[model samples]
Target chain A: MNISGKNSISGMLKTILQICFWGGIAFLILLPILLFAIGKHLNSFVYVLYPNGICFLIFVKQFIELFNLLKENNPFCNSTVKRLSIAGKAAGIISIILGAETIFNIIVIKDEITSIFILGFMCILFLGVSIALYILSELFKQAKEYKEENDLTV
Target chain B: MGIIVNLDVMLAKRKMSSQELAEKVGITPTNLSILKTNKAKAIRFSTLEKICEILECKPGDILDYIE
Candidate 1:
């Protein structure tokens, strides 16, 4: 449980940022496939693509914040970085839920059982990831407190 | 909540600057500042040991029980 202060926060931030970056790329790359499997074109929907794009952008911003902090080794930036990470995770979860809903609606209206099952599975996976992220946040907060006390004692 | 870092006193007794101590302890100056300012989340035993060695002091010299 005892980790170097520099390593612990940086390690967590790095992992979270990497997930966000890759997750964004995965969603963007799969957009066309998802739309095609749903048997719809983006041009047919007005606001469907934009929400996912916005969430990706937020995640990228957080990634940048984390990168800057890592480079500067700034302690003051840790809280802000953690906050932005939570915000990015929240946005990602919301966008995933919305995307699932849209896909589900399309599948039901089109009587497509396969797409419905796939989207439902994806929704479940997203829920799992969101829950894990929330738990990690709480754990990090506890670790932070524990580290504070240890630092004082030393 | 009960333990406080008496780093300021140790630094004064040793005539050491935070930056110097940070270098000796192998931590960033900002981390040292956090420790000195009572904002750090935790410290490693190795770092604490380094600080004590550099300051020519014991753990008790740098920490105190607060009422």
Candidate 2:
């Protein structure tokens, strides 16, 4: 199996990310209408939804960029590390947004405790993702340094 | 960064072109250019040995240290 190329695992992951990204946009676009159709006692979840969606889109975009680097077999570069750091920050923002939304749901919505529990779980999940992304960024930084040194050893 | 590559000086003294040296050293011209421009982080002993052998000079002749 080729690791880096037009036809590779990273390429597959990139395609999946693109699907998730565009699918997310479509879902965001249709969400208000869907909520309207449901006609529940929900008060202005749009604010929370949009911010979280945008953060998720940004996070996915960063991964797409990182996968582009992987496709080029140039993953061990400064830009990859920078992209990972940005993705990590985006993930952190997502976690914060989810945390706030969870609190808001508990205070204002006050209907489904199960949904709130899910939101809290999601908040913790994104926070873990954020920390994992930061660790990956650090790993990439070290790998980039080592690659530079090795490339220069001629 | 304090270490300087004196490849040009040795190449000039030997009356050899970088392309010729790169060809004889079995390395790419881009790698040779990297070393020449001092953008290289380190030199492998094997590559240094090849360069020294090709140029008929010591490693010290191609590398210099500056404060």
* Candidates 1 onward: DockQ, in order: 0.16, 0.83
Over 4 Å off in model 2, which ranges?
A1-15, A37-42, A107-112
Model 2 per-residue lDDT tens digits across residues A1-154: 7756656576576678999999999999988788889995445667687888988999998888877777676788889889989999998998998898899889887859988999899999999999999999999899888877887777
lDDT of 1 by residue, A1-154 (tens): 4222544565666677777777777777788889899898776332554565665556566656656654665533347438555754865565476566657467556646775666567566656656666676566667666655765543
**Predictions in order: lDDT:** 0.68, 0.88
Estimate, for each residue in B1-67, the C-alpha lDDT of model 1 and write its tens digit. 7767889998988788988888888888877888888766566889888888899889898878788
Q: Give the per-prediction TM-score of chain B.
A: 0.90, 0.95
What lDDT would candidate 2 get against the real structure? 0.88
Fnat of all models, as shown: 0.22, 0.96
lDDT, candidate 2, at A138:
100
Q: Could you give candidate 2's per-residue lDDT for residues B1-59 as a string of tens digits?
A: 59899999999999999999999999999999999998988888999999999899998
Worst 10 residues of 2 chain A by lDDT: A2-11
